[model samples]
Target: MTSGIPDSIMALVVKQDGYNPNPEGGIHFETMEPYLEFKEIAVPDLAAGQVLVGMAMAPINPSDLHFLKGEYGQPRRAGKPAGFEGVGTVIAAGEDPYAQSLIGTRVSFAATPDGTGTWATHAVAEAMLCIPQPDSVGDHDAAGFIVNPLTAAAMFEEAKAAGSPGIVLTAGASQVSKFIVALARDSGLDSICIVRRDVHNQVLTDLGATVILNQTEDDFAAELTSTMKERKPRFFIDAVADATSTQVFNAMGKDSTWMIYGSLSPETPPLPNTGELIFRNKVIKGFWLSPWLSGAALDEKLAVFAEVQARFSDGRWSTEVGATVKLDSAVETLVEALADPRGKVFIQP
Candidate 1:
């Protein structure tokens, strides 16, 4: 064990009834106070292949909210800490050689569904799950290593593998979408970015997006159809799933693939028109980073990780941090985080 490691640490615990039934009703910090509590808790012990991390920073992500609301694919136990990915320094390790080697090194890791998470002063994670951060990467960038960046790279690889001349992406101004634009440009592929507002048009255009369509505009459908027909984009990466997805699907060419990775709209998207699905052979599927990484070979995972790190180091890809909060202010911080969708909110635990 490391010399200064504590026996107990502060953590934000999520209760069984953490989720609010009506998200539109807004959070009542008083009544909903029972849902999450900040308190001192005993530090978890390291398992055979685990290492205890002294968490430096963790982000409040959309998935974290979904998990807290009990809407995520993976269920979380009540009374456990909440957080998905973070950057930390390894304080102690189990007897395994790899675990021991990680001791005292700063690394990034995603929380296991086994109760422990990064929203604590310390967390225990499988040693192999942690990736040592290079000195060129700062704590802020490394804290988000596992989610948006990796997903952007992976989705781009999928589009490339499909031999797509171009791709269509929803939520064009999102951090991940920006990464997609940059990566797609680097790979010599074209991208058509769909956003809800004209404010993001120039931002995405500057990012190398070949086509920028504002969904709020009157001619959005016509523009999308015209661009899709001309580009023949074989892949559609969607984040906002609603009627927008159906429109994109109708615009795509035959044999095009629609990959839904996030449900930002909180409503299930309507299925594509019957004729398009039946005769065009359009495909629809979901993409989650956990399953994608798990199914990947070790070399493939390493290559992607290396590419993500290099981009961060070179300043080619990054998410803007809108705010940072302490563990004790989790409730208030979460309220603020929910109100802002423009950038990431971080917890400096």
Candidate 2:
């Protein structure tokens, strides 16, 4: 280890061969015990463009769960720490000037594409991926800096660029959906939010959801069809890629587009509405945050980081903390807490 940095760091890591996938296909208490193991490992050395971050906190996103199952886009590296993003102070830097400049500065960073992750006392990241955090943005919000916020901003931009009169969003109670709903409200674009629980989702109206509908309602299909016809929405941004998503896409008029970003449901949806594709100009596509960020211009990324900080600092966005798991107990406690995931989950390293 260099200078004062410790020779060893405590991390919650996965054992490659020992990783147990829940038969049900998601994280579950019964089958998740071996998914993570708490260990004391040697500190990783920095590469030329990397910096060592002493992690303060990291959020548990759906991507992390998918990662545990080897279902996410990136392959999970066993024996390494397991977190995608976090807020921390850069304690050490590599030979590069940009990395050196970040030393001792507190920032929010995304784990490198193939690096040991942030669920540890110290983590390594490329300097270019780190965003210096403003004092006004608290630790909780900073922990969730990139994934949800950036995706929300990018998807909202997609909706606007599509020239859609309104957009349909599934999983209305989620943080990303709330941010998009608020953005649409400010931009004067109509938004329809769909959720399972009527009582809990009705409050979405406060976040700028022009219409909040319960998918389980008896007359949901008729009501959605009527509203879609009236609104003439041409874009459906979906997280749940199930039969319901297909139903929502079918509700829209001709020339509509369905953009799927996540698959919260285990079932795969089929392209049953081929007539719309053949006759009309309706299309189906996807949106992934990784490529979008990598493909964005430097100025655009910087502007997004600045705007995200401003929004989180000014109360326009709040990443609510539901549970903060200790590094040692994460192997077991995390699965139970995520059963409901009442608010955002965090790991304080």
Cα lDDT of candidate 2 equals 0.83
Deviation from native of the Cα of residue 62 in model 1, angstroms: 1.2
lDDT of 2 at 267: 79
Q: What does candidate 1's lDDT look like per residue over 43-76, in tens digits?
A: 7766768888899999877777666766666765
Top candidate by TM-score = 2
TM-score, model 2 to reference: 0.94
Tell me the lDDT of model 1 at 334.
69
After TM-score superposition, the amount by which residue 187's alpha carbon in candidate 1 deviates from its true location, in angstroms, is 0.9
In Å, residue 251's CA in model 2 sits off its true spot by 1.0
What's every prediction's RMSD, in angstroms?
2.6, 2.2
List where candidate 2 sits over 4 angstroms from the true fold.
17-29
The whole-model lDDT of each prediction reads 0.83, 0.83
lDDT of model number 1: 0.83
lDDT of 2 by residue, 82-150 (tens): 888999998888889998988888989888764578889988888888899878999999999999999
Every model's TM-score: 0.93, 0.94
